[model samples]
Target: MSNPDTSSGTLPSHEIIVIPPSGHQDRLLLLDQCIHVRIDVFVHEQQFSLDVEVDEHDPIATHFLLRLVPSLTPIGTIRAYRAEGEKYYKLSRLAVLKPYRKYHFGRDLVLALHRWVNEDAIRSGLQVARVVCHSQLPVKGFYAKYGYQPEGDEFDEDGAPHQKMVAYPS
Candidate 1:
């Protein structure tokens, strides 16, 4: 589905602003907005514990945030990072506000991460590489829409069932 502004009708390019990973302190401050959305969706809405919400990977991971145009309200977030001595990035913490989910905000966030992964691959002197995520069982189809396939057995993550989904970024 095409993204539509809150008021209805097609959203213009300017209706959305995506903040990509850049500097150090600036990114950290902006990441606070992303963490807010994650807490709302993962901890509060989904009843996950706060302890599992944030982890050590956060500091080094590249983050992205999507905000409303004029209001600058953060509505979605995702992160990408390669594991220690690993080549592929692990996409994680993808979330979109409940009311904004109908606008395909999650799709936009994932695509933005993919673009970042592609760029990172080029910077590392490669064409593209594998990307993976521990996708919640319920959103398996959603991840599949972006070429991710379940590659392993289901397991528990933060008390919820999850599957290891893999994809190749391009």
Candidate 2:
């Protein structure tokens, strides 16, 4: 069944805030919110070990946090970083709470990240060729809906099956 939060046919008042790396004290607080969501969905729910869930890329990645309006509680998050010396950006750690999954928050998060990439690329006069993800095999189709194509055979990541997928901007 779809979440009641969305089944009513009325869009929920929510926002995806982009947390670009900057010199701000509150940046850690914002990142804590992103970490909380990831811990809930990735570590607790999915059983990924904490060591594997938190990685070196986190410090360099651009993070996104989704907050429901009124209460403004953080409920979803995702992050992306550019692949070294390459025209590719890698998206990772996308998660939405169980109740919020039906709201299409995950899809919105990806789209928002893509939008940010396009704008940043234009502003910096850099050509970004693609966005890539090491998606869990089960949800590869979710990324496909956004035009990502599988790049290689499935491989084990943190004891779970994952596959490389890439999406070129249209």
Candidate 3:
């Protein structure tokens, strides 16, 4: 179902803001909101351990925060990082607030993150071949809608079925 305006019959405007990489002075601006989204979705709702939900990668991964316009409250987040010795990025910790899921925030976050990564790679003269994610099994089709393909056999991750999916930047 689509997210509909409650009173005026219009949805609220929103935007995605990319968090600077670790060590940047502005990096902490959205880090709390990003962690809030992850805790809500992955830890509390999805039964993932707090330690697992907030892991080592969080400090280094590039994050994107979705903010509702006007109020500017963050409601969704996604992150990505390049693997050592690899020519692609690993996308992870995508989470949308429960109340904002109907607005396609998750999809928007993914697309924006992909674009940001591609642009950065180009600027740095890095040849990034693809964006990869370990997608929860039930949502594999969601990633497929964005041109991601399953790369290998499905496996269990944090008690949920997961599949390695890959998508090339256009």
Model 1 stretches astray by more than 4 angstroms = 1-25
- Please give, for residues 1-170, the per-residue lDDT of candidate 1 as tens digits: 23344666465332333444556457766789989989988998899999988998887888888887676777778988998889878999999877677668788888888988888888887656889999999899999999999997999988999999999966
- Model 2 lDDT tens row, 1-170: 22335656576789999885767777889999999889989998999999988898888889999988877788899998885676678999999988777678999999998998787667767866478999998899999999999997999989999999999765
Task: For residues 45-125, write the lDDT of model 3, one tens digit per residue.
Answer: 888988778878887788899988887788899999886666788999988877667567788988998898788679767
Note the residue pairs that clash in candidate 1.
Answer: none
**Consecutive 10-residue window with the lowest summed lDDT within model 1:** 11-20
Q: Give the lDDT ranking, best first.
A: 2, 3, 1
- Candidate 3 regions off by >4 Å? 1-9
Deviation (Å) of 59 in candidate 3? 1.7
Task: Compare the candidates by lDDT and give the number of the best one.
Answer: 2
TM-score for each model: 0.88, 0.91, 0.89
lDDT of 3 at 80: 90
* lDDT of every predicted structure (CA atoms): 0.82, 0.86, 0.83
Better of 2 and 3 by TM-score: 2
* Pairs that clash in candidate 3: none
